[model samples]
Target chain A: MTAAPTRLACFGGIYSNYLALEAALADVRRRGVDAVYCLGDLGAFGPHPDRVFPLLADHDVVCVQGNYDDSVGNELDDCQCGYVDPQDNHFAQISYDYTLAHTSAEHRAYLRQLPAEIRLEIDSRRVLLCHGSPRRTNEFVWESTASDHFLERLCREADADVVLATHTGIKWQRQLAEGRQFVNVGVLGRPENDGRRNVWYTLVEFGGDQVQVEFVPVEYDFARLAREMADEGLPAEFQETIRTGWWTTCLEILPVKERRRGAF
Target chain B: MAATLPVIDDPRVPQVELASFDQLWFQVAGTLCNLTCHHCFISCSPKNDSFGFLSLDEVQQRLAESVPLGVNEYYFTGGEPFLNPQMVEILIATLEYGPATVLTNATVLKDEWLQRLADADAASRFSLEFRVSIDGFSPETNDPIRGEGTFARALRGIVKLVEYDFLPIITAARSWPEADEARVVGEFTEMLRREGYRRPRLKILPMLHLGAEVERTHGYRPSERITAEMMKGFDRSQLICDHARIVTDRGVCVCPILIEAPDAVLGQSLAEADRPFGLSHGACYTCYQYGAICSNPSAASGGGHAARPT
Candidate 1:
């Protein structure tokens, strides 16, 4: 019997941007994708979670806890992701508080019970859904890790053909030796660092034997969101990132050695 | 085929000094800090003394050996260096070598201590600089992270330094949007000017995720880090401290930041530490891409660019 190819959406870090999420959903609907999976960190950092949550629910997106989502869901005081300098002034703090308040309790509850990992099948091909690293939700797994053994072990344990991840927002896909692939669907609220204003999302088409993931940059008018955040007196910093497609509050996100190393 | 052209790892690879100055930060009080700021790179706090104090004798012993090898200045850092009872003596001995800088939260620079340090700075032949870390200008802004009343106490410390004609360089983390940075720094500069210092050196630092910082936010995303192959065109010379060493109470170590990392210890003496490091961590990129992270001129300093001395 000829196999029916399955297509899926692998994406996360919505950061509460309704415009971007709506655009992404439209794409998913058009593609007639098979499954919708999130990398984690649904909100917290951006200004518009109220709108993004409904979309996730309507789409019945499979999601996980990003560090920000974890802190908010846990009712924790800080964003457990270790991304900010506690000593920051009200400008930054105001932003964090705003993001925290914008997060829906239902979404927080959803995130609270969310699985750190998930496994999927595409016509018999295996796939793993992990936020950052397997088992460790807040860990940062990048190309720099360059460790084959760990990924190899993960694929074996999950009995999967590919791993999908998010948190460090960027589009990347690499093939390990046999048939394993590591892909990060990227974040929707922040710019992709490629100097583009549009955020990133990914759609994967899978056949019985092969899977193809494509980076889709979605453009939207952030004027309403930016103005709304400003009106809400949310962190001006948060408002700025929504408009600029980048973040400036680089506290915990900046590695100490790298901080000292100076970035342009 | 007779002339075997050398591979890219050729002798022609240029070398640049990463940092002649070493941030041999003496976590004098260990992980014990005066304030429990959320994004502390190493996550130090008042009660968390995971690392312990190195007495005057220990510091002096390390310094004695360091000067002979052309080791430059010494820097004293801690949960609060002054928290140490013998911190004065540590400073006294440190100044005799090159110059000394003590990084303080400025939450507790008592009058008696400041008077002594100012006297020593004037007496010393080498340059002595005091760098203070403050997150923002106002209490509403700075206090949230540093605890209430810290900004008030910190300001008094800065005022005292200015009174003594000691232009202390104020450092603040870049915790706001880039568009607001200039205004924020300008306000700091203006505040410092009104407080009696003419030229205020402010440093805008990138946050390092460590210790409590990890709990506050996430650490480096797996995306950030250096690889073996990426080091090909990388200037080996820029990782300066790799060739040098830090003589601590324990022994000589690779670099300041790596003190906590395993295999951080290179050898017993400064000369013995002559070797190259793999630049395995995310922080290595800071050194490789930018020149130095520890030894910037001001707190409001700009982000790094490909700068060569004019």
Candidate 2:
């Protein structure tokens, strides 16, 4: 086995937010990270779906397929976001249609080939990277809702010492039994609905038996992104979430604790 | 009327193994209910004491036992969960271990109870979700089924829950035809918004033809029972028995829906209840159709195009 890298940067759900991707990659390079990984969802909720591909390609960011990526790549009719509410589904369909129409055939093919999970050894600790939970790609593992035992079972079933996922778009970390950990490396595609116009990624450092997980906030050109979205005639609700951190659409999937934290 | 058919003694009935103990349910209020709705599957009523209230101590014990099983979520249901005096305390205790959802009729909710629960929910890391059962958008359509004046009373309770900043999910069993689902849901949403819920969350449930519903509507046909062939390549995760067990005053039952059935009681503890259950009941067919009907939308088994990664 090769020696485990000291520092690794991971982010999830690009959501066509190429600006944030560019800024986050530059920041990762400046920090001198040994490896960078992305947890799928390269399209949706932003303008210019093609802009995100070059960023990932140039940075050599290994990615695991997300639900959106799986849907768009396979030309699925819906985003497979697992929304039950009619209104949420309506807006999701709008975004999915826009994304599917804009994403190039080349990028779609590339997404089709991406792995569902990436396994690596970080200082002898088994680190598993997935788009959502280890068991399901679209599963929502919210901090307030996911029990410690449930997370531990997921990690144990996947046979990993540390599990990293990001479907809920909110960043959280839980210390599990036997000093293991589970981290949701929040998304760079959108603000975390905390009323801040900044997105986030995670920096994980492993030294000996200890692991350090840090949520690094990335500041990008939100005004430009908003303008671009408006120019593309995307829903005002999507642009609102970009300008203000509060999620206007897709609010139904949020659990009570996470939803209560936002202004929606 | 259709001819009554004999029960099938077929050996081909599929048995679903407990995949994981993800959801643990408690029949907190037992068979006691404030309102005897026409469509109540278990026929829960104020006078129905077939099942008794589960004490806070019993619930706490089960909660402790559920930890090792890696239960994903906790649920409370009954004739009405809030009727139990210790309902708030039980939910508060449950939030310590995991998220808690209570199925309730909005007719009997107390502001003080909501206040305590809201406080507890605010303090805990987990969420406390209230699923308020309201049959219709107006009294004209709902009163005949739920009881006279229940619609207004329940609407008031929902308003109070909103006042507590609890975005309760308004659940209604579909009493209308399947084609009218869109219209019925739209009306329900509009009514809720007018009644002060700016962002209404609604879940429409398929009627379970059992208990009181058997008398109101026709009982399930013998063909409704799940067959062995039906389980082939089927996602058993959609079935509540695959991932959940209910703790009642009697003991741990197979599910919240089948607590009254003679064979539904699995065992005395969570460990003993971790066994396969025969899908013989007609209600099991309903469950098979509507996956994870008892869980919150967030915790529901994704049933559509969203594939679960093996």
Best by DockQ: 2
DockQ of every candidate: 0.01, 0.62
TM-score of each: 0.48, 0.95
- The interface root-mean-square deviations, each candidate in sequence, come to 18.0, 1.8
Which residue ranges in model 1 land beyond 4 Å of their true spot? A1-264, B1-25, B229-232, B235-240, B243-250, B296-310
Q: What is the lDDT, from 0 to 100, of the residue B161 in candidate 2?
A: 91
Q: List model 1 lDDT by residue over A1-264, tens digit each.
A: 223337778787887777888888887888787678787777755566767777888997878666666667777665544232333333434555767787778867876777667766667777777776553465444432223434555556556778888766656776765878878788886765443568888988877566777998788777777887777767676666667655544432332222222211
True-contact fraction for model 1?
Answer: 0.00
Best-fitting candidate, measured by lDDT?
2
Which candidate leads the pack in TM-score? 2
What's the residue-level lDDT of A103 in candidate 2? 91
